[model samples]
Target chain A: MNDTFKKLFSPIQAEEALKDRTKEFLAEKTQRYIGVRVGKRKHCLYAAVCACLLLMLLGGRWVYFTPITAISIDINPSIEMGINRFGQVVSVDGFNEEGRELSSTLNVKYKNYTYAIEQILNDNNIAALLSENEIMTITVIGPDGQQSAKILSGVEACMTERGNAYCYFATSEEVAAAHESGLSCGKYRAFLELRLLDPDITPEMVRDMTMREIRELIDSLSDGGQIDTSSFDNRGNGHHGHGGGHGNRRRNGRAEQ
Target chain B: MRSEQETIRAIEQYSDTVRRLCAVHLKNDADTEDIFQTVFLKYVLSSVSFESDEHEKAWLIRVTINACKDLLKNFSRSHTVSLDTIIEQPSRLPEDYRDVWEAVFSLPQKYRDVVYLHYFEDYTAPQISRIIGKNVNTVYTLLNRSKQMLREKLGGGYEYE
Candidate 1:
């Protein structure tokens, strides 16, 4: 039955009909006439301009600033972070902090510590901060209280400022260790790093705050949180608290911190 | 870079594929010709270059499908020829072939596009994915679902040769 159907519906060679039509079309397109060619030229010019304008509009230049922004973060020290115009982050690093790269293991910190980092992440309303390079800015705050942030350009270059403590978010080895060791959240330093980097966040406060408060903070941050420093043109320029000056800068920066 | 003559030759060679694709979609000779001309004109005017004949053919097929879709949209508004009317119109073929074509034409635009690209154009799911700008899994699922629908429409009795 299928064979019969195939034979009947298979493409037939209407070769002569196609060839004759092709010859006619080729002739028409190539034909030259001495009569007023200005109209043709004018039409061509108009089409070219329209095409150029359309290309310009669609050529990634006509930035439509969407209200919702997504940001990606790479937990890999070797990878860079990227922030799109819409504020979505895309990280492209191969490894996380525990020395494991792409392993599927989930690193276990203490329940409270894991809860703390998760709380900050949840409170900030981050879209998704996987160990990928989609994040706009990555703030690596050390266990010793020092902090630094870097914007990743590409997947290869680890572009960081000098003297900054670089820590990948979660390595496979760390994740495996966390899982096997059954370490409590307090044992994980990376989780602590995330807490310190978040200005409104503190470990002790997690015990005090309800889940709703934590969720609300995350929602607010996700919906254009006051903490987004990437939107400011002069981030970390030391321009304190006035409009176009240090005072306004300090106020805005402090608000996020 | 290919010369103008070479591009023209390529178009001439693949004109039949373009015509068949248009014919299958439009089901009207005049409309097919219009789409064919538009597709070729696009090829002539386009500054894009293809790495191989297969690439050029794929681009032409995609453009032809898009042109056919545009014509279908306009036809829906100004003309009253429904797809069912076209499918039911008398053909000289046997019932099974007629039934298959009818089912093909009756498919929704998305499903029909995948089926036509797969069966008529002989494109693999991955190739269809690239041509239609869809994920491989999506193309695979569309093909599987479309084929099942076609089988159901055929009363599930016919087996492929």
Candidate 2:
């Protein structure tokens, strides 16, 4: 085996690629020590890029264990969360004013995902929005994808345990409302269901509509999913003659169905 | 810095050895070229003095192994190569030796290193231990494992050293 292996090893000497590239390969390997010339500059750049990329590749895994993490939620209130490896809150912020105010007050750095969100939403003013039946969306994200999904489910469970139907609501009602009214999961879908209740109501007006206004809309639709459109004149806007008000209004105006 | 004449002489004398060592271990054309260039560049720029030609050759072999290891660690994982990749448009190596070479390359890196150094480069297990930074016992164990693996891969027809 040894003699045969030695005979075979002779072919390892047959290098054809390095035959003509001797001068060029040497120029590349030693060009840094020699000097910087025009031709060598591109080689230098390529070398620098490769070095930096290798360093980044090595650093990428080490960075995963790093204690600091950031999570950005893109709901309308759009909160950005900076968290630590232990799931402690570093900071909570939002791009919008409402998100900023809610995140700033009742602030504690070391807290779990469930408690922090519960406290923030429990604020009197924030709770007032939900109690008054306004449409709001809260998305919870953590530092990375795995962490984000974990935090999302955690916060959703926390809200549900408190009997707060305000958050974590993707029941058949919302899904059915979405299907009937042609909307999806977020607040926009909720707005469509509200649209079926009152044709004259605009999005701007929907925001200011009290819980009573929303509840009446919900009550008007019996098990059949039909709205009584008769009470539209009594409370507010009275353009009630045509239930076809959906045709001209910008929201669902193009009733593509 | 060494003179240009010295650089040319070293390249002519040792480039083939360096290239061969790299090929036997790496089996990748691009990687073999890298080690080949790196060893020659070190010869050109190195300031260390050797007591004799034998000393210089040993030093070159050690550096070649170290450079190959460094390049390999930088990779996310080791990539395997078929013997056909090495014998592209082949000019030598009879079919019997070719099959053994393929079996050698397919062994895990640790075993392959000692086997290449022992059988191909004719380094003893103790010499391989010093060059590869492994213990003497470890080198022997690796060499044994390598022989068994190669025997299995090549259907146990070949004899061991």
Candidate 3:
């Protein structure tokens, strides 16, 4: 039966005309087959390019929003700006009641830190405070790195254009301790000096005091009509440069030419 | 889609096997042509990668069988075609071979594929099950019943192996 069946189907070959006709049908159906592969390759290429662009967009967004250094400006309002590596202010945080009000009114987020500082100083309320000899301390808080030094130098240049303001650079650890005490870096530095003179002074007592009031309190509590210059200058890993402020220059008498 | 050269190579390689499977299930030249074009056109458009020549041949066989079944099941083609013209060019066959062919096609439509794949194509029962998407026991039963039917129709002298 197997041989008989083999012999039966062996003679029934597909005709040559049938093969020719099938080839023609396939060529017409597939557009000679070349068009389909090219179309598929183009589709794959487009999808890959779109995926790469999406990844780059997300990566760029992450890079732009990540802050590497912090600048704390304390003039009783006590607002801090978080600066990215690109020197843009990515965040503005208020550390006190008046600071929240000032932070809310400022449209300085995502601007360069210099422009943001200029906007703050140009505000009518801050300008009035500076003219009244209210001490405005601009503190740049980060590691003792080039970026921090650069931001501190830029801030000192801005201070030179005004009066009754100081520029300082502090380490991240000192700023973290300041945050734990619920004080910005500038007021926290004053509170540390005051705590050395009179150990009973608390951060809450200093949180509501103006920097001028804190400085006067430090001078009044000291032993010989002067606060400890060591506490004023060398607290943690930080350094200060006094600008042209008549009240501060005569009071502390620590100015760097 | 496959390249033109690949499609042509596949057509030249598998056309005869596809034609034989179409003959097992189909009744006319027009239906055979439709299955031919449908099967090879699917090959041209399909992205399936075959591991070996045997795998490619099995795929074409399965596709041709299914295409023939689809054409036969259509409402317009469901009417019975005459059994005398079942095998194309039946006049060219010898009387003994014609008797065997007639007996094989007479064993009901369900058994025709197993009979052809088993006796002619020399496929094992398990291979037929995988190709036809049926249980191995079902394929064994169909092959047994088809052999018995052929034995009865063709007489006891011939071995229905």
Candidate 4:
């Protein structure tokens, strides 16, 4: 029966086949060590390629992370940031003009998210662009979801410390879907109305257009017999009635990135 | 430490045993593959030399077991392979013995390792202890306990030492 057990439970893969895969795996790892996998006929080429890869890896380690984790902030102002293991901001992709300005303003290459956000918010140009009243949504994303949650909490605390009540936090994939559906920006009544008014309107445009400007456009469009205003009361009606009241974020398909 | 051809040769000779160890010990295929790849990678890069091929094989078994334990310790608990995976596998085992085979798998991890090395790999208790970094007496105790548990689950029809 022990013989039966030996015959029965020896692993299923044949000796030759598994060895072939392990050989392939080892060959691939050589590339990590020497920058190129050793080749039989092209030894010189392999050496050159390995040298180049080694240099590139050593050189770029300071500038980038090979396996990166990033955050996408979607609200009316859109910003995406990539962080390295040291918590330095390595890449920043911002969509709004203010966000773009923020991208340029926040040139600190090696600061944690909290410090980076604090610096960006304090920059004269970026500070001038921020309206404490406007809701801001931050989404943390990375290869590791648990670490992303920790980053999201740290970022939310940073924002809260700055006296921003309208700040919200979410995961990257969730915010990505929200941005795709136009719900993230639409959470803002004025921006949602603007989006309803023109789907192509930019976040900068959303920020520039006042509630009065949006209401006038809707009223004009209503009077012109192009749109209906009573139904415009759908979601944006509250902004006009209680502009000062702090409203809980409505989910009617709105997302802040 | 060996040339690429020599490394590949060694990998070809020992890969199956290393992989079997991983599949038996790890929770899922992906983690198993990770340890599998990592073990070979370590072999290719390591400077250590052996007196004979048998020593090389023993080193790999020791390393594979350590790598698996390290990964398990550093990470959260892993999701093990499902019953469906075991049932669907195209194994050499006779249909009647597959359930008993899986029952051995259901043993506590330490017991499973002891039973697998003792019964399938044909290692003596002292050999198993040396490979797995445990006392020889402890290996025999676990092997006995594992056999008792398997008997209860699989019934007395399956013979045991």
lDDT of 3 by residue, A40-61 (tens): 8889999999999998999898
Instruction: State the TM-score for model 4.
Output: 0.44
| Local accuracy of candidate 1 as per-residue lDDT tens digits, A133-186 | 122222222121111122112111232321111223333344344334332121
Residue A55 accuracy (lDDT) in model 3: 87
- Model 3 TM-score, 2 decimals: 0.60
Q: lDDT value for candidate 2?
A: 0.58
Best by DockQ: 3
Q: Whole-model Cα lDDT per candidate?
A: 0.47, 0.58, 0.81, 0.62
Q: At residue B144, give the lDDT of candidate 1.
A: 82
Docking class of 3: medium
Model 2 ranges with Cα > 4 A deviation:
A14-20, A27-257, B76-93
Per-residue error for B65 in candidate 1, Å, reads 0.7
- Give the winner by lDDT: 3
Please write out the lDDT profile of model 4 over residues B14-109, one tens digit for every residue.
Answer: 777777777666755667677888888888777798888877887898898888878877544545546676555435457767877678767777
Tens-place lDDT digits, model 1, residues B1-161: 23347645866678767766765666655676677777876776565878998998899888988888788788454267666557643264465467677777677778877776676666789999999889999998898888788878877676632
| Candidate 3 chain A minimal-lDDT segment of 10 residues | A236-245
TM-score of each: 0.42, 0.42, 0.60, 0.44
For lDDT, candidate 1 versus 3, the one ahead is 3
**Model 1 misplaced stretches (Cα beyond 4 Å):** A1-9, A12-15, A30-257, B1-8, B75-79, B82-96
- Candidates ranked by TM-score: 3, 4, 2, 1
